[model samples]
Target chain A: MPYQAVPCRVLSLTGGKRDNDLILPINSSLSVTLHQDQLKTTTTAAASRDFTEDRLWLNGEEADMGHPRLQACLREVQRLAHKRRGGSAEDAGPLSLSYKIHVATENNFPTAAGLASSAAGYACLVSALARLYGRDSLALQVAPETHWPELRVLVMVVSGEKKPVGSTAGMQTSVDTSPLLKHRAEVVVPERLELMMRHIRERDFEGFGQLTMRDSNQFHATCLDTFPPIFYLNDTSRHIIALAHRFNAHHGRTKVAYTFDAGPNAVIFTLADTVAEFVEVVKRSFPPATNGDPFLRGLPVGSASLPEELLAAVVMEPVPGAIRYILHTQPGPGPQLLDDPSQHLLGADGLPRCSA
Target chain B: MPYQAVPCRVLSLTGGKRDNDLILPINSSLSVTLHQDQLKTTTTAAASRDFTEDRLWLNGEEADMGHPRLQACLREVQRLAHKRRGGSAEDAGPLSLSYKIHVATENNFPTAAGLASSAAGYACLVSALARLYGRDSLALQVAPETHWPELRVLVMVVSGEKKPVGSTAGMQTSVDTSPLLKHRAEVVVPERLELMMRHIRERDFEGFGQLTMRDSNQFHATCLDTFPPIFYLNDTSRHIIALAHRFNAHHGRTKVAYTFDAGPNAVIFTLADTVAEFVEVVKRSFPPATNGDPFLRGLPVGSASLPEELLAAVVMEPVPGAIRYILHTQPGPGPQLLDDPSQHLLGADGLPRCSA
Candidate 1:
């Protein structure tokens, strides 16, 4: 099966909309690995330039550019690439290397369960484009030479249809001003968070949900008291918080921490070690309707990469379609150059091909 | 001139301490007027079958009953009163009324500033007695009953303490509660809250300090979120809240509101409001403080019951001795007659007072 030629594969990783403005870039590297099955394989070939105008074969048939946001994304990415290479004869020469791209996207989850689709989509598009254009290094570098501008471009492309709903800019500013930033300590999952994470990876939905809800509440509270108040949590958020608190207090601890993007959807983070206990507690505590099914069917636990032989764990998971697919990821280095050409998605002519 | 026992002169009235467990009753009446020099002068005294021993004298000392909370308050008030009423009560009767109460308190303003003293002190005692005596009403209605166990009893005998904290139970509980309670309402000072009651008048301090601070924050918020929050206006309180929000966007409208009890002490409540403008904006726009004066000072205003128009506007001046105070109070009912007089402080002989 050969990969099709598409500009970019937009992965709606988060199930819900995120406040684009809050997603400011930090001095850290971000990485992702795509599975073969996640893509669309096809034989049809179409004209290379003006892909937006052309009815390119998507999953199966010729797909039209129906959504304006999608079109804006395509144009924006192309513009950014041209800018990087230096525009026109007066500008620098063709950016290091260019390529024709192909994309395959899956809904993966249901519509509007308040999970974050924007985060997943943006993260996925950036990942896929980086792979296709061989700009992986630039994409992953923590404090890259082109930081703000590049981050803005990526944000614009990902936010496409959305009118930049205050991406991570404000949040970043707050972090900069935080006095506690100096004392910043990353809390690695002790046995508790770790066990929960493992359970999530194993598709233990109940257990995962319990831990995620609890952790999210604590995280948001911490944010609230940070110097000048930063409220990522609202009244509704608090109601949800109270519900989780009541649930945990009544039953044993279950999957509970909830992480909110600029928007209100909760990204639940659970501990890997206590998956079963967490799941059992959740099932026994919250109503089935609110918590969904007991077996926690269809939940996927994506594994995070770790150096030590720590317990296998899933950093994130799919809560049905409510949440975009979970990215099982861990700390990783910036993007690096690939020695093999076979992995390249583009030909010398800068057009994407099924087999390099 | 020898200070005569102004026949029937009531030195001060005090409703005892109120807390989660105890309610003390203040159901005795007496009438007296202060001379130009602020000395008590009695006009009428009811000759009831109840013995002279049943009468409470200002300087009369009382024995501790081993109740720590009660002991603490009685000791404090008595020490302050000194030997005004003369010797201690000999064999006072069994306390008739028993009150059970619950209290929740917080200051809306800076604690050390002195604005919280009166509000805190009054609320502490009144609430404590309400709990001790099982007086059911809210903070505004402990006195002024019509029939037997009459309002006079409460107003007269209770008014013997040298400097008793003012009570809001009478006013707050009198107002009706309705569904409209949920809707945000404005607190219009139809009239200033500082009107002087013949029995309870105001005093002026040369400058604003503690009272201003407490009223600006604690008292105001208390009133805003009262049993059903009431709103009192203090220009300074509003400005302060507005200023806080100006520096931080996360600050809400609910952050600032002011309320004043019978004394000069005031409190302010703060929260984010849906209005386009915010407390922060107001705070920033305000002029900087000059020298020692605060950027703003909260003035007390509310309706008084007197028929005469001039007296209606009588503003309570900040008394030097009156400290800033704040306490959180909710809706409650008025004082009731205790069915069991076994709790009465006077003995069966209806003469001398019991030990407690």
Candidate 2:
């Protein structure tokens, strides 16, 4: 069986309790899911006939198939598949429930480097699994890509270095130790999620941008409040934040908003109108290192001249190559199956076609 | 009449509501006050019959005499003095309430550089006023300097650059915007202050160090929660924090603690037994740039040998000259009068003795 792999950009992660057994959103959870053309993970999942055991390969290397979350996803997918086929496997044509599964996933971006690479990987893995087993995806989309055409995303790679504290362990420690995390989960997030959803639905960029920046700050605040504390945003990340705030302050409004995950990379959201100028601002603030790889990638941006005053306004010491690169992208369609045989990540030998 | 000058270090700022008028401790407030032989603000006050109007000189420049807080301190002192003399101005000598005052103050460290120089300045001003007016000082002492002789303070000067945001304005904005700050002020501080005082009384190094670190982190957390998000702890400050935590974890208990005010400099608290080793660790972590100022100052630190394992455990890229220098000192009595006439900052001409 062949399947499409879905890679997603998690705009805002708003939830407390994580359910290891289910793929669907809980009642209390609300996340804005969209797709970006760049920074994706491709997973090839198949129901194997000859193999006697379930196997998994991540980025061309063999990984534990018995990982709890992986097991949970596999179990849920199979159960959903069974339920879909009139509560039994007999209704399915050739795919059998007893067949062992083989999965291989490859990420275009750095894995576990806090660029939400895991989100894309997990999403792709589960989507591929669901597709192979004749089950529909249970992921609840807050809004379609068409809902906000002007919205754009910039993935600022401050550091692709592996996160000192990965998200799972960080969140667990935060849940156990942070009082601010408890307050944010129970009291702050619910109302904030509602406002975010409304802002997205109404295409209210100002409200949306402000809330996004504040929520990001508050989330990191809780991380700092954790016992022994967790530091995800390094100096470069903070400089980016200062630049964002300064850029907005210069405009006298929220023209751009920055968010950070479990690592130092910054995900900035802005409108199509503001993107060019803000990109210029970013370039001026964090000049690319000489003789390095290309500084900008993905969707092309128009040339915009930075005003002298605007350049002066964003006061920061330029740290060359602080940002590895800038990935410019926008709201895009979800997973699509590749009909051509050459597009398959796994080859005829049932192994990764290319090493990561 | 001539009066003594004083300077002190604010060990922990535990209360939220600030009084613009009084020098005494508010009912809900509790702070650990200690004096350092270095890093002080010196002030000289005199009741001058020759002067036509009250005047003030700060750091060798003639400053406004009508500043609200200064006027408030003067009025309070005069009222206390009048009351002490049977509520009659006639009972006093030639050094009467009606006489115009001349005052001069100087800070050895950088002013408003988040070293709590303002605290020292204010304490010195009020003490000088009280001494000249024959009124007893009313500042409540939580515990005297002799109580914790081994409790050492290391003022790690990460940057002497004036802070991006000053404490007064920053706190005002935080109070107006940050929900976490409000919660901390109203709900968190009261309980934490009690524990801090208890830790001091019990001489519980573990409890005291842990609480100190957490409170410092929480205060900065609230700062981050403020609108536009105030960022006082820069990269160097965060690196110092990481070093402190790693050092403690290596020992399997709390041996050292770090705190930050509204700037990047770190005020680390540790016991005498741990100071030498920790200073060695700091020197290793943030090695001094060649030809720069001396790395350590103030109280003498004995030689210490760092174990290979301990050095390997605290892994951080040595940020050369990230910390300008470390000022090492300990608890001492506050607000001592300089009886020798030569110590006065103001000469017989009622002007600053030296230009800043």
Candidate 3:
């Protein structure tokens, strides 16, 4: 059996739509492939196996292989592979429909921490499976990661703890109870997506940044509008949002943008030109917990001295250690295969590696 | 000239609508007069006064005499007084339109603390001036205070500091930026107000409490949807909201309801029967900063033991000093004239009393 692994999947700037009705009418998002932070998935398929069942491991823990979504993905892949064979044994050699598959996955960062771990995980899984089965899986690519080279993403990990309410359940409840969710999904999102695409195409940082923040806010607003209401953003998240707004308002332009997923973490978007200054501002507003190690990862941001007026403008009661740390990254390619055998998450024995 | 003082005014369960277009279509609210939390104002009209202009003092400090709203109220009162004289000099006695007015007002509670100070103060001013000028000011009242004797209000002073953004400007921004605000004001408010009124009329605490909380959350949701967004509820405010929801969900009934204005403070409503238990839950969730000098004021609430499961349901990190204090009050009379001269806020010189 041949094994394959894909690294560095994408995380979207916009939230995913789960409502089937809303998804059919209009479902769009602006996404950027992350370079530094990644989720790696390894897949191995055997036409003749000792074990007759498919198996999966996540972060060294064996998870439910019969998970409905996983089953659906596996069924779809096998169906495509069977069709490609066309009843002839010639095309089915090692990639036959009767093969059992073993999969192992792990993330370099925190899982279920609102860092889009599921998105990256699922994308990597499907991509790796497609490669193993010699099947082509079509996925939408609005613009390549290289389209905007100067764009940067800062993942502010406010809390890496698992969110109390999972996105699936939270969004389902929102669809059932929130009156404004329908309006937002049907009316606001489509128009905003068009504008976002335009801003990305034109590289209009200010327009892109403002729209990003507004859409994120409207999403949370709908959550708040839900019955028994949901509060995803905590004090630290709110403070980060306020700081972003103040920093932009002081400069009289949109210098920074912030988007929050289902949890308290914040993902900030800014251009390469303004990243240094904004980092300085963030550092001042949310002082790091310790001075021993670097509080930032990925692309290094040089220190920039902000003007007195600018510093004064964004000044608030600093909430020390509000942000645990930041992962500084930029747009890069989606799901690249690792050519090195040592990089595989699964060992040669068809099980997750001990260090995975 | 005779002086009169109205002791108590009212606070509504719903937020006030300032959008002229929305207000014209549907502007209804259910209010209850608070007995213990009162804003007292004393007014005297001198037919032959030495001073030519109207004078005013609020909380013993001289305020802007030419404030637009105050001026408009004064002009309307004088116009009514002049018309009532029948255009005959003999009909116009000491209570004449040419009289110069002197007004003094004070509140026992903290000013600008989201305690409905402005509402009470303005209502007191209008009621007092109308009596002095022999004019009648018709106000729409759905029900008097005695209508619901069991209904109680608990003012949770999350932070007594003045709100950063006043409700006036905040509503204007919402009208301009938030798409949901228009829908809420026009469609949601009227229907919700009807339901609230029916609940009040039928003494349905469950319905009334649920609608009150929903309306308040939607109001804040609109604020969140605004561009650059408005955050009226801080960490402590959000905690209180969550606690209320958890408590209600635990019992599978709406035992307590919370409503927040344009500030962090929470105004909670519960029936007399549930007030003691809910108060116990609140005390456990938010323990007092100091056990001395009773953390609760207004109507005394007898202690009740909450069940262990109920306590477990509302268990959260106690934010010490998050709430400064609580005011337990009940609905009472709107406004009454105090015949006692000693109760007047003004001295014999027609100025604010030194101790006022």
Candidate 4:
């Protein structure tokens, strides 16, 4: 099976219905694509007949193009472009191995924070290159950021002190070592993906939440199943899971569902109706011990009515400041169009607008 | 398939090779018989012509005789005792249900402490009853406690503060809800059990330790697989697991292996040669902050060399005094012979010697 190059597969091989019921990726790329405007990785790419060689840079520093994944991406994309306009490339004959490109990438968030920064980086590169090549095809698609206003993502930023284990490398190790993962990918994902799609179509937050939580759990289970296991969910992340269950079960339905990426940070899914209350539970469960606030980032629904039942059932002492902060976000479009010149990473001169 | 439900299965569904490869109860009685001398449970039984009905008092409180498991144990033993020499001059006429017995049982250990206190209690009752009925057939067996000299078990006492989830109930829930558990019992256990037996016979510490740890992990994995899953391992327990792997990997051998019971307490298995060093690692990883002693009970292998590699590899801050005290014990013989008359729970009057 073709592996999901998307970064969400790092945390869990299965990606629940983010398309919200249309179609699910069979390999389980249950990734929550964040809005790239604020946490943008601006990649500047220029392809010229004059260029002699290909080069790349990440966050202003030149990065090696020797990695096989990079080579594969470059090869596949260039191959497609060459095939499309071989004879007429603005008087540039047969586009194969003729043009050289320089790529520059940057990240607004910390690399390896398990925030899917790689996802953003690769996406920006793909977008910028697509624009640079001046080619528009089904291979690259983007929508406006305000497409899905109801869907929200709250990132419970955890301590990202450990060295980042790259997504694909971690996934490769899991595939090699984990039997549970094999069963999940082969047996569990297909059925769950279908169900998740249906639930998404119905806009059933409760069903969606449950599917999200279970798939995330199964993913973590596979991680644990890996020999010499990997632990992405720490005490804080575990508490979030427990709290979500307790809160949902107490309410007789899922008000919140949490998904952990490769890092300890939790991406919680909740409708606007319940997001505020879920945030309250988060704050109460993980009180800010630090002088700075612990609520992290989220649309703070004021002191939510934490029911006696939920309060009693969650049964855990707050490990103050376990969660650093929260990042509030809503699902929107993919990579957006740059209307403002200042927002463009590349100038008309075909060089990076910003120092990279 | 019938549950191997000997006491070993009572602790974990996947029974480890506890008896040094002797008779493995394939039915999953993965039970480790505790020595009655050190961990004692006293029971008194009286069979009188005057008693109208069989009654039981547990820890001085009357317990219902209607529970099926309890009734099954009583009925099976009684039927066996009655079959032997019954209807003859040596036995009462027809023997079956002819004698109404009053039984009183007591355990010195705390039941909720995650120690197998109930196992010790039930074994004592069964032994006393077997002796009382004069049933010498292969119905009951006991030997010295120190049978296996090389084996050692250290209990990392965890928080038993939560209400105890009964083992049978927990097992039933797991069986009902966990598909992974079904796969484990039907597929994983048989193969692993054979390997465990082989490992034990070979007296291979590394092999034995690896099997124990894997079985424990699978069992817990099944628990996680359960719907509304049960969590026996807390942060402390998970930390211990990570530490064990890091320690083993750093040393490039399985010097120590950790297994968890139904609760958070970790049962670490290590050979005598490495116990001292493993203990030191445990000490350094989990330093005590309370005025109380940290090394509960073990060969005070006085600060064995905590290798720089292991120390650096297991990246964790000391969660001061996470574990209660550790119980130091080696694989000893079974129940010992009680020679003193005062040691007998029952008096010459066929009644409990104590006031209860």
What tier of docking accuracy does candidate 4 attain?
acceptable
**Clashes in each model (backbone N, CA, C under 3 Å)?**
197, 0, 0, 22
| Candidate 2 local distance difference test against the native | 0.76
Q: What do the candidate models score in CA lDDT, each in turn?
A: 0.29, 0.76, 0.71, 0.62
* Model 1 fnat value: 0.00
Instruction: Estimate the overall C-alpha local distance difference test score of candidate 3.
Output: 0.71
Those runs of model 2 whose alpha carbons end farther than 4 Å from true positions after fitting are A1-34, A82-94, A159-162, B1-30, B64-72, B75-94, B159-161
Whose DockQ is greatest here?
2
Model 1 interface DockQ: 0.03
> On residues B1-356, what C-alpha lDDT tens digit does candidate 2 reach at each position?
33433334444453233453453322254445545466666789887778899989888899999987789888978887888888874856447788889999888777777777777787788888888887778767778889988898888988545588867667766766776776677667778878888998999989888888887788788778888888888878878988988988898999988888777888888999989999999999988767757788888999899999999998577877788889888776777777787888888787767853
Q: What is the lDDT of residue B136 in candidate 4?
A: 45
Flag the better candidate by TM-score, 1 or 2. 2
- TM-score of model 4 vs. true structure: 0.81
What digit string (tens of lDDT, one per residue) describes model 3 on residues B19-126?
443232124555655664432334433333565778877777888879776787778667667777776765454555666777777777766655656666666777
What TM-score against the true chain A does chain A of each candidate get? 0.40, 0.92, 0.89, 0.82
Output DockQ, candidate 3: 0.65
Query: After superposing candidate 1, which stretches have Cα over 4 Å from the reference?
Result: A1-47, A50-106, A110-114, A137-258, A262-268, A290-295, A299-356, B1-356
- Between the candidate structures 2 and 4, which one is better when assessed by lDDT? 2
User: B151, model 4: CA deviation in Å?
Assistant: 3.1
Q: Summarize candidate 4's per-residue lDDT along A113-146 as a digit string, tens digits.
A: 7777776666566666555555553432222335
